[model samples]
Target: MRNYWVRIALGALVIFTVGMVARALINRGIGGVRGVVEGSGPLSIPLAFIPFRLGGDKLGTLERVTFERTAPQSVSSVRLEVKLSDSLLARGLEGCRLAANLDSKDGHRRLSESTFWCAPAGSDTALVEYGQAVFRPGEVSVPLYLPQDLIDELQDLNFDGDSTPISEAEIDSLEASTELSVDSAPVLRARMGDSLRAEGMRRADSAKGVPSRMADSTRSR
Candidate 1:
């Protein structure tokens, strides 16, 4: 009887562990039901328990978050770290971290750093620092446009980068980086900083600066 009871308890423990693991995976997927709950409004996540693990190869994720109001307009700080995979049980989100310091009252969008990749091999790297951004609320969508010269300041960006009036394609790319909340602007606005750092702006620093068209669009809006 003692042996049988032990076996039953062990089995129950295993089943409970399995259920928790399954629930975490299902809810933590990006855009998966989990993401919607954790990554949405007010930045506060309410659930029974949030188990956080590490991902070192494929994708990393975090959800069901909460924020304490530090100031009137700012949420103080936000941090997200998780790992998912292009393939199941894939290695994990190696060397992955995302940080955002947003000031909605001031319309400032700052993305500290984003590094996603496999351990020992960085697939993608994006970093922003040393400056600030101004944002404007849009009707259909909230669009964040660079100060023109700032985009050009990014190391690799063409001072004349298809200066075609901030095309929709560019906007879409930025959106992928910045979402509706958590900065609420497209990423292109911030990635420009990465471009500047990557291109070693010091080498090709231009007095001519970014295109004038940049100003027209930003001001017009």
Candidate 2:
């Protein structure tokens, strides 16, 4: 009887241990999905994953959201591309402004922020103005400029105050919140999920068939 009781206790302990491990793994996965950079530098969060809100109401659905650093060595600029939902467009985007806020890992620090004026020219499709660049709602190439002080802060954080070029700086994690102006107040907000990884950047570059400068330099060597 004593041996049987011991076996039962051991079985229970094993089950409990396995359950705890599985829970931890599941939580880790959830956290990653919530906000973790991909292996590449670009952070593309699907619209379906983002929650949009306008005051007490849920804003309409968006099609896509993408944020990416333009160049391998450039850390002062990033591109933000978002596809406005039909409901949002129907509400009118003329004279609206799109803004983004970038926060540090702990969400306690504001790394950088930028805003672009949106002036739609049509209903189904429109050219929006961001700085001197004009682009359609879904297609994006213009880079959002970051402040110099913030750029310095980002570089120091990634490089540990070292002068090493940030060509491959591991940003690790960042939180991006996007907003759209309605009636002069931001009515739509979406927080992007996760960190941006260097590995993913390489994959993106390869997929675009655009060789990185690192590769070009290596070939020249």
Candidate 3:
């Protein structure tokens, strides 16, 4: 009886250890998602982890931002390019949104821009283009754009044009320093029907005991 109990305890310990290790691996694999936004100024906004779920039925996170030039020194139209990480694109993109950050009042911000859903990536890459009007002196508001959890990260963005725009040489140097590809591809957007269908399929698969592929698709080296 004593030997049998010892064997059972050992087996339980082994199972517990294996479970913890697998959980750790899953967490590390399902890492944060990111994207880069360029133009509107010399500097750019790099948004990440804007309220995404991990290790669940949810597959990915969506980030939408609008770049606006303030009045007195505004361009007719600013060329904005957003490059998404393969991880975010692989799990699938919900949409792109142009949000304005209006002058905040009543201790809250408001969104005046529109929202757009992007198409799923059928290949390794995709692109889209869009145009937005500039408002001088008045602010464009994008209140609920960023993931609420990661909203604090926006404080680091240098929207003020006081700083010199990145020089061509600097841009070239930075591009050379990184292996990441920066494309002028059209912005990626998915249709609302596609999004709903995808979500329904994911839910059905979940109920059928199928594991989510988000972590497998999003794991970055």
Candidate No. with top TM-score: 2
lDDT of 3 by residue, 89-197 (tens): 3222223233222223232232112212222333212222224321111222211232222233232333233334434353233233221211221233455324544
lDDT by residue (101-140, candidate 1, tens digit) is 2222222233222322112223223333222211111111
Candidate 1 displacement at residue 190 in angstroms: 29
Q: Taking the tens digit of each residue's C-alpha lDDT, what string does model 2 give over 45-135?
A: 3333232222222234333333343432223233333334432232233233433233343323332222232322342122222222112
lDDT of 1: 0.27
- Misplaced by over 4 Å in model 3 are 1-43, 52-107, 110-221
RMSD of each: 23.3, 20.1, 23.7
Q: Against the true structure, what is each candidate's TM-score?
A: 0.20, 0.30, 0.21
- Candidates ranked, most accurate by TM-score first: 2, 3, 1
Residue range with the least summed lDDT across 10 consecutive positions in model 2: 167-176
Candidate that would win on lDDT = 2
Q: Model 1, stretches more than 4 Å misplaced?
A: 1-43, 46-62, 81-94, 97-221
